[model samples]
Target: MSLLRQLWIMVITITLLAFAGSFAVSMLTARNYLEQQLYVQSADNAAALALSMSQQSKDDATAQLMVTALFDSGHFELVRYTDVAGRVVVERANHAMPEGVPVWFMRLFPIHVGAGQAEVSDGWHQAGRVTVLAHSRYAYLSLWAGAFRLLIWILAAGLLAGIVMQLLFRWVRRPIVQMVDQAEAISERRFITITEPRVIELRQVVRAMNTMVARVKTMFAEQAARIEALRSEANRDPLTQLANRNFFMGRLAQALENEEFAPSGCLLLLRIRDLAGINRRLGRERADQFLQFVAGKLASLSADRHDWLLARLNGADFGLLAPGLSADEAPAFARELLENLAELRRIEITDESDLGTFGIAAYRHGDALSTVLTRADQALAQAEETSNAVVLLSDSDTQATLVAHDWHTLLTGALTGEDFLVASFPVLDRNDRLLHRELMLRLCQPDGRLLTAGAFMPHASRLGLMPVLDLETVRLGLVELGRVSYPLAINLSSTSIADSGFVDRLVSLLRQHRDQAGRLWFEVNEFGFRDELRALAAFGERVRPYGCKIGIEHFGRHFGSIPQLYDLQLDYLKIDGSFIQGIDEHPGNQQLIKAIVGIAEGNDMLTIAEGVHDDGEWLVLAELGVQGWTGPAATGRLQG
Candidate 1:
């Protein structure tokens, strides 16, 4: 039972005991007073009657008349007059029950008194003795009336006390409830504090809880800072603060090999002209500052493009990888870079007008990394001959570029038709058991070609059609879930989650399929999630009731904001593929992964590694406490 209920029962019991005691005392006191008054009246009346009889004649007629008159005029149970020798002269008596009083009450508290007696005289001699007794019906009535009044007063007071107790209980309950909530939040890995109550005991409890939460927050903040530092040390270029050559190559390889990555994109290579000559003309410090300035400008230009990868490839060469950029748009992008680099010359950082040369190479999926590098290098050699110092090398068989209107038409037509399809990749546990299949949306053309989400999603987003596509994907996932017994995960775009209407529709769909909702998972990319945390949180809240799971894919890219995840209550994290690539041979990345696993475990979230390509990587990830794995290796194991 709750403490409040126990207290209420105790209060009621004490009130009843108090009422009983008071009633007993009041009834006893009243009965005693009434009994005393009755005795007094009997004695006084008997004395007065005796005197009256003494003053009158002592004859039988006179005595009988006086006795009868006295008995009739006053309340008496019995009245008698006898001669001095003890012979009866005259007698009168009456016996009757009291009215308006309960028999039970009379039996419980019956009034008792002695009858009064006196001597009578006739001509200076005793004629007969007169006796008078007073009835106790009036006394009983007074006692009963006083007892009833006491009971009514007791009842009124009890009611008032009960009301006051209820209000007091409610006031006490509020602070206790707040304390309970704070404790639960802490258990869920969300450190929250409550206001200290005015009550001393409750205030102490709340203060202790707040202090613990503050300490925990500080601990987590320090841990996240350490992990971020590890990430920088492992992947960042020391001088330029851009991704180092190894990290950049690993990310480029993932984009090229991952099926969900963009089908085609552009790679740009920028080389400083005569770096040794500039270093000798200016001091080493001045040349280092110049390099930093160039790196800063490149980072600023790609600040808004989360998909773009900027890296310091070497001391004099920098690389930019732009996914989803077409060959037709490569020249314009290269000219933009050239224009930005011109700022260095105008600021006199270098005397040579031709500060740098640009080489742009367009690449498609399945192309060799070495082949792309060679093409960019050839483009750089050609740019050194050109006056503008910028050249773009394209593949001869590149596909035709689609305009905005054409893309809208294609996507709308495809969505309306039955050409949209979904492809599943298995995510597995360390025991080789299937966790869930991550579903990717695809578009089937009339020519029997499959177009991945990367090929069309950008256009759909631009046309505000992500809500429609995302809802359809959820519907398809539900249908598949009903056909199969296993759970399924689907990706949602940042744009779709930001749209309130889309959230409503998605939640409605999940509600309609409540049984399948538990088996359905929704994930958003970490890049998008960091910017739309509030929107994603609201979306999670709406769908959580249906048992739908929400998570962030491509996790660990923003290690600095891991602490912000306490309030999200996410179900899982899909570590980015770049960090997972060749993790078995990299100790620094292993520590980073271990830290990530610890953080996720602390929050009760599952950590899944993405893009596992070999048994070595899979084994290392499993040893590092990854709960799930999804990639080429995981898919191969599922097939085997």
Candidate 2:
């Protein structure tokens, strides 16, 4: 139990104990005092009445009259006068019973006080003995009233003290709660510190935590830097800093294979001719510098395109692939790139013929990488015969590419209308137990073809409609969750996570469905998380009370150092496909997956893999302790 709760319980217990003890003692004492007063009054009254009877005639009439008068005064329960012969001359009795006190209470603490008695006498001689008893109804009534009043006071005081202690304990433990939060953050991988509190003991603890956090951050930073360096070295070319041949080929293979990018795209090659001639004239050092310059220019070209990849394919060849680009556009793209390079090297290269030529080919569905490369190479061989010739192979023809205005109009229409919705992909555990439905937003095109968020969200993001897309996604997920009993995972963009208004509205929506909040999970993409960590963490904190689980997808891709996934109390980690691909054949990736699994284990998080293909990779991942799996394999399992 929490210390605050324990303390409150202790306070209440002590209060009740003290109240019970004081109440019992007061009740017993009051009963004794009242009994004594009643007895004294009864004894004294009997003596006075006997004396009055002795002073007067001791006849039966007078005795009966006096007894009647005393009984009528209502203090005595029984009074009697007897003659010397033991014959009763006068008598009085009362049968009134006290009310307003429960029988159980009276039975629990019974008070019995006998009536008082005294001898009666005339001036020097005894007239007749007089006897009297005091009425106990009034005394019982008085005691019951006093006890009720005492109970009320005690209860009121107990309640007031309880309220005060609740507030007091919460205030006293406020700094401790913050320290606990900081510790939890550390456990989650976020090293953090807090201000020292006023209490001397708590201040010492907080200061110690702050020092520990500083050391942990330093330690993790050094370790993360080493891992990041190794990862970068494994994928990047040393000289140009572009993706190495293996990495480039892997991406190229996926581009040709992935369902999202296979439909329409272009692969272009820029070949530098007479490399030996230029290297001999410029020397190896200048030639290397020239190659680096060219690599930089090619890298700069990718900045404008939404989905693009550039790589150093080989010593003399460089490759650029533009996904979602149609056929005819490849020519202008090829021309613009060559023109930029020529303008850049215009002063350096005196002869325009010294510049390289371009060979481009547009790819459609079911096109093989080898076939496309052959087509581009044939075009390059033809271009090599001419000066600064840019060749578009026979395969490269026109199919229309939608302009930006068209996308804006289509996406805007879908949002304002009822066409915007989401489709869920299943996430299953190792035992094929369904975990959740991963909701991906979809836009129903006018042609009745459903377009995935991957198809339109890029343009939406650039146009600052990410927040709108996120809001619609959340709405769709909530409505979907209500229809199903299983949990659902919703993706929130960085823009929506950072937008205060969006967060406020989203939180309110979650609250309105508070009962089902636990069944709804939220996740942001890896890049989105990197875009705004603090905002995401704060947003998670706000919704945490509603029982929503938060985590990142495409995890461990750019993990140079663990981004405070621990701090977020992340529910699960989905390993990116880059590491998951061909894992059975890649020992290095297996080790990387093991390392990621270790991190998740330490943080008490669930680990899953994305884009899983082979059964061997799945088995390897399962042996690596991945609790859940997603992607095509898991999807197929769900469907089966």
Candidate 3:
């Protein structure tokens, strides 16, 4: 039962117990008092009767009648007159007894008491002694009636107390219910703050809930800020204040996919008329400023309906992807942007106002970035020769360009068909022994061409297909493992690492091949680990059994994260190639390598240097406390 129900039940139980106890005490007291009063009344009546009989004549029937009448009307049990020698007696009796109370109540607490007695005699000389027995019928009646009345009073009092208690409980529980409703709302992800309650205890609960809500709001705000930072870093160009190449390419691809009018729209490439000369005359910083000014003007001229996107492709090169715009409309937008740039340049460069020269080239759908850029370069050259502020290619390039292939189709085909393959890379030990061979997955076409991760991973990720590929790769690795006894390592995708089912499968695989588990290694990228370290660590602990080993690949550059290394039971750390490429000369690189070694050593983990192609870097690393090394220097197989 709930707490409130239990408490109310306890209250009722205690109240009933108290009522029973009071009833018992009252019955005992009332019975005893009645017995005492009856005894005194009998004694007084007997004495008075004896004195009156002595004063009258011996055969006085009047006195006898008076006493008999009183005894009969007073509900007496028995009245009697005895002679001096006690040989004969005069007796008076009442009718048979009547039950006044329930038999169960009477049996449960029987009211048994001795009857009151009295002696009747003539005064001064013993005439006849009158002995009387007080009746129990009147006492039983009185006791029964009193008990019934007390029960009714007790019932009324108990009812009133329960009603008052319920009212008080309702008042007290109001704020508690409000707090509960607020908590329920929060559980449903609908945040609500409750007003402070009058009850001190309930007010504390509300305070805690309010604090929790505040914390959640702060956490949400921080998460939003983090997402915004990531977005800005992904899209914004720090230097030109325009979108970067990645953002522009993403939008361009999206535009191509929108088949209605976006895929058939114009793409434009804009360039400074004479960027090198401008840099030579005004210095590099000032030239960059000029480029920013041109970008600003282009941004202002583009209409929102056209969905124009501007990006800095490189130094002095800008791209405009305008979805739903024709090649003719592109030149108009370019002309307006150039005019704004010209006006701004005239105001800034008062001495050589003609330096505001620029070029624009536009192409309708199917024109590659390279082709458009070439046309824009040609236009810029022509503008330089003619000494004009702006120029566009008048002739449309009617020749067919290479069609941008749908990468999603290729990914889907590769994932569904038998196009994906796994390749092995050796991760050697310190003595150039094959400690483990890492399996790297590659996608190959039916045309005998191999595709690297760069060719399909981004598309696979965009299509939410990494987990499938990772699972397939793992199955293939297990298949290949059945063929060999060498130590094998399989790389896990970020999505796979976060999946609980994948973790379970990995553990199950190891458990199935318990003897081979010591030879099996699981690898994850440093980037993936950083994203979900806690989850990965928990996964690591879950799979630590069955003798499997876990290691991180591309593990360097995030030196501040070394503290977490102590918590994770990683078997090895693969230092990134950047630090190992030229470790002897760079002092910073040397210190970093040593620090990583120290961190791993302190945590009882082995450190491996990747890309150690030469003996010198290898020797340096060995001296710096690296226990394992894997690079081109190590042979594919362990030499016995």
Candidate 4:
């Protein structure tokens, strides 16, 4: 319990104890006073009665009547006039002393008073001895009332005091609560301080806390400065002052939270396509100069001065957060960013060579910092695989135009107007056998043309609509599967992997079709798996009971961080299209394909090569041990 609560309990206990003590004392005093009053009244009545009887003539009826009257006037338990022979002449009795007070109370604090006796005489002759009994009823009643009144007064005082104490305590604790809150915020790395209280003790405490906070804040500032310096030393290419992996993520996280520094932006994460070969061909120092030159060129061309943050995310990998640019503007910016690097040096390795394995991804507000970075990394893989100068996330006008269009209204319309549709492309084995059909989404527009994801994905991504879209797609796919089951594989975007609602909806959709769920396969992008590994692991466990298989698409692109299959429970991997597109002549491509196939086979996961075009490339991949294929050359229903 808190100190304030303990103090409150103590105060209440003391108040109750004091009230109890006062009540006991009041009751005892009242009882004693009443007993004395009764005894005195009884004794006075007996004496007066005897005197009156003596004054009357002997054997007179009047004297007897006066004595009888005196006895009657005394409200006693019993009153009797007796002769010398002990024969009762006159008698008065009230109901046998009614039990007026509680026995327990009387026992707890018994009050005793001596009975009074008095001698009575008339002129010469002595009157018959008189005895009187006193009833304690009136005394008991008076004492009870007085004691009750005292108790009422004590109770009233206690109530008033309690209210005052409560107000005082609240007043006293208010500053403490504020201080505690300030401390909690500080713990969360938010710098804050509270005003000092007026109370000397509390003021001193607050002052100390403020001093401590100031010191810690200073330390944090120093540490941050040190970290910035170290990052510049350890990770920066030195010439460009661009970050490596260690610095990029920290800077990105800060940018995401800081509105003033980075209002809205995108990151262009790129890699030097083949730095080793460049270093070998052009002496070490020249290659180093080339890298610096490329870095500078990228920095110069990447973003405008308005609000974009560009940096090297890691070795050969670059990132840019271009704030305030819509998806439509990013691809153009990306092309510029990549083309500038090509001007760094003449390509001696090949006359038709590009400068870098430059993957350029664009991010708007509300994108997870980690997700954007991972996606940029994924784009870099594709760039390396495809040998594309730059692969802009917004190159496709579908995503860009949809992003430019009002998405809230469109999504609402699509959801309400039944404009959502799902289509599947078969993931087939080498001999043209269906391994499973990968489900893809298309939005039926008002104009009636089926719109592929490339049409609306960027908008969905920017609007934070991926999770909702993915969930609805799952529901719709389940419905479709019930009608026609063909080993369904549903695609989940990176956003859906970490969303609880998406997982829940998927579970519900599966449960509704329990019998067919076994044939279901859920596919997540490699970038999504890499970004949210924990969420992926949890998602795998959540869906495992349904017997649905989980697979990764665009796999082998992120070559560095291959997650343990034991941890992922993945059933298949779709090798990125870049690796499959032009694989016949490139020995390096053949070697990489062999490594990927070996990794898949070793892990007990089936491998599918996407974007297989020609027979020579297909034959090479088949020889390299790729099990499945999907591309233009593959005889399948593929919408362009």
Candidate 5:
């Protein structure tokens, strides 16, 4: 039971016990007083009547009359007049009993009193003894009345006392409840402290709890500082602070799947005009400022639509996915965004301040991502011909995009048809030594044409077939691990990690391939990592005995859940490609990368660079304490 309940019970018990004790004593006292009064009345009446009889004549008639008169008074239970010679002259007795009082009550508390006896006298001579017994029925009525009133009063007092005590205890123990809540919050990764209570003992406990919360907050601050750099490096474009390609694409993919954001949605593509030439004429700093300016305008345009997905796709390209807007509304949205970008001329730039062009594509729910992008690209190309106008593209072939349950059918067939293939990319260490092979997934169409994961994984995810697809990849990866002597790294999707059945199958697979377990490593993206780290950790524990490594890709994309990362059994973190694309010149990225490297070093974890394409980026990564690298640079090293 809770402390409050237990205390209340104890209090009630004590209150009842005290009332019972007091009530018992009062009842006995009242019963004793009534018995004494009854005895005194009997004795006094007998003595007085004896004296009165003595003053009367001693004749039989007179004595009988006197006895009859005394008995008729009803004050005495019995009255008797007898001769002094021990002869019965006149005798009278009463057979009266106390009434209205329970027999059990009288039996439980029997009242004992001495009966009255006195001798009568006749002119200085002893005549006969006179005895009297007073009635006790009135005493029984008084006792019953007093007991009923006493019980009612005592019960009322007990109920009132109990209620008052319950409220008082709850108030006094309020601090304890707050302490419990604080502890629960801490367990949930939220550090909340409570104010000290007035009670001395409770105040001390609250102080201790508050002290612990403060310490945890400080620890979280130090850890968050580390994740903050990684988060910014991954989630945002370095120059614009807008969502990067991968994050935006994830959101866009989600929007495409949901009817709330599809069927009546539009995709707007903004391509900066003459970005390369502008960089040459206005210098690198001015060119970046112009891009930042353009990004700011795009940010403002989508600010009101919190669900809108906006991203810096590449150097001169940006994409926005806005749902809940009709196809006819696309022109208005594009015009507003284009006009906002045209504000570049207001920034005192030379030459043509044409800003950028807008490309819009509208599609229904379940439209393939490729079709949307293709339409948007075509519109963008057409818009480029018109200088600064917006271009809209309508799908020429609606049958091209798979909708309804088509993706499920396709994914299931692909799994069973053995149309899935695994491709390995090299992960090179700082010394250019091969650390592992990152396995990439590919699905082939019935026409025998190969398709990259970028082509169909979105559909697979939307259809909730990622577990099947991901498991197939792991299965193929295990086979590949046996075929090769090196470890193979595989990516896991959020859906797979969230599925208990998938975890079970994965555990069974790892156990079956115990000999090759060390050769297989699993990776989850930032989205997957954030979505189901606990599940991942549980799975990790289940597979840890098999000697496997689990890491996160695109580690810096989101860090709001970084506090939970401490609980996750992650082996390494791969910095996102956005930060790696041009690391050498981007001083901001270099500094953030350095901080991330420090965090990794402190945690005894490895840090790897993704999408390293040049020696400049490689050198910068080497200087930033990055241990491994992948992408074109690693591929080139492997080829060499």
Candidate 6:
């Protein structure tokens, strides 16, 4: 039982005991007072009646008349007159029960009094003794009235006391309930604190809990900082603070192969014109400073573009990977970079107006890395030969030149026709047990060809049609879940989650399909999630009651934000494919994956490796404590 209930019981018991004690004491005191008054009245009446009888005639008729008169007038139970030889001369008696009082009351608190007796005297001679007894009916009535009034007063006081105690209990219960919620949050790896109550004991407990939460947050921050540093050391260029060549190449390959990435994009390469000659003219220190200046300018230019990857390819070469950039936009993007580079010449850092040359190559999905590099190199050669600041090269046959209007029209038609397909990919645990199937959405074209999300999602986002598309995907997922026995996970765009209307509709849909809600998982890419944490948290709160789970996909790219996840209470983290590829041979990636697994486990989140291509990668991820994985290897396992 709850403490509040126990306290209520104790209060009731004490109240009852007090009422009993007061009732017993007051009734007994009233009884004693009534008895003494009755005895006094009986004695006085007896003496007075005897004196009057003695003063009058002592005959039987006179004595009888006087005794009868005294018994009738003085409210006496009995009146008697006796001769000097102890013979009764006359007697009068009346017997009647008390009225207007309960029998039980009388039995519990019956009144008792003794009869009074006195001698009659005439001229100093003792006459026959006269005895009289007073009636107790009036006394019983008075005692019953007083007892009833006492009970009424006691009941009113007890009720008032009960109300006061209830209010006090509620006031104390509020803080206790908050503390309990805080403890539960901590157990779930979501550290939270409660306000200290006015109660000294409870206040101390809350203070201790808050202190512990703060300490744990600090520890998590330190660990996240360490992991972020490790990631930087392995993937970042030391001088430019941009991604190194190896990391850039890995990410480019991932983008090319991953179905979730855009089908085609542009790659730009910038090279310093004669770095050796600049080093001879200017000191090595000055030339290094110039390179740093150029890198800073590039970083600043691409700061707003989260999808763009900037990297230092070599000593005097920098590469920028802009996914989803169309061939039409390639010239403007190159011109912008050239303008930024022109700052070096305008500032007189380099005398030559042409401080660098740019080579731009537009690539399609499934294109070889070496082939793309050779294309960019040919563009660079053309720029160097033609004395132009920028040159663009593209394979028109492979790359589809879809304009923004065409994308908008296609996506709108697809949405209207409900031409969307969901493809399920299995995620398996170490023991080859299925955890859940990740759902990928595909758009069906007029020609009966299927297009992956990467092909049209960027356009959908630009057209502000993500909410409708995402909602339709969720509706499809719910329908699919009704047919399958296992769980299904669908990715939601950050833009869709940020829309209040979309979240409300999604939550309403989940409420309608309550049975399938528990088996549904929603994931947002880490890049999008980092910017929309507040919106994501609100969405989680709205759907958490229905047992829906929220997770982050491609998680390792934002290792610095790990500490911020304490409040999210996420269900899982899918490490980015860039870190998972060739993990068996890369010790640096192995340590990074291990640290990620440790942090996720500490927060009670499941870690799943994305893009596990081969058995070697799978074995390494399993040994590194990854709970689940999905990619070619996982698909092959399901097939086998």
TM-score of each: 0.92, 0.66, 0.51, 0.44, 0.51, 0.91
lDDT leader? 6
Winner on TM-score between 3 and 4 is 3
**lDDT agreement of model 4 with the native:** 0.66
The TM-score obtained by model 4 is: 0.44
Estimate candidate 3's alpha-carbon lDDT, on a 0 to 1 scale: 0.66
Local accuracy of candidate 6 as per-residue lDDT tens digits, 44-156: 98888877877886778988888887877847778888888899888787778777899899899877778999888766888689988898888998999998899888878
Tens-digit per-residue lDDT, 58-176, candidate 5: 88898888888878877666677668877877777765667678888777676665578898987877889987777666776777788888878777877887788788888886887
Comparing 1 with 3 on lDDT, the higher-scoring candidate is: 1
Give candidate 2's error at residue 209 in angstroms. 1.9
For residue 361, what is the lDDT in candidate 1?
86
Kindly provide the TM-score of model 3 when superposed on the true structure, using C-alpha atoms.
Answer: 0.51
- Pairs with steric clashes in candidate 6: none
Superposed Cα deviation of residue 300, candidate 2 (Å) = 1.8
Runs with alpha carbons beyond 4 Å of true place in candidate 5: 1-9, 51-129, 135-178, 192-348, 351-442, 448-450, 458-553, 558-640
Once model 3 is optimally superposed onto the true structure by TM-score, how far is the C-alpha of residue 121 displaced, in angstroms? 5.4
What local lDDT does model 2 show for residue 131?
Answer: 83
In candidate 4 the C-alpha lDDT for residue 223 amounts to 45
For all candidates in order, the CA lDDT equals 0.85, 0.77, 0.66, 0.66, 0.77, 0.86
Rank order (by lDDT, best first): 6, 1, 5, 2, 4, 3
Range of the 10 consecutive residues with the lowest summed lDDT in candidate 6: 556-565
Q: With candidate 3 superimposed using the best TM-score fit, by how many Å does residue 330's alpha carbon deviate from the native?
A: 3.4
Q: Using TM-score as the measure, which candidate wins? A: 1
> Worst ten-residue run, lDDT, model 4?
394-403
Enumerate residue pairs that collide in model 5.
77-133
Clashing pairs in 3: 77-135, 120-129, 120-130
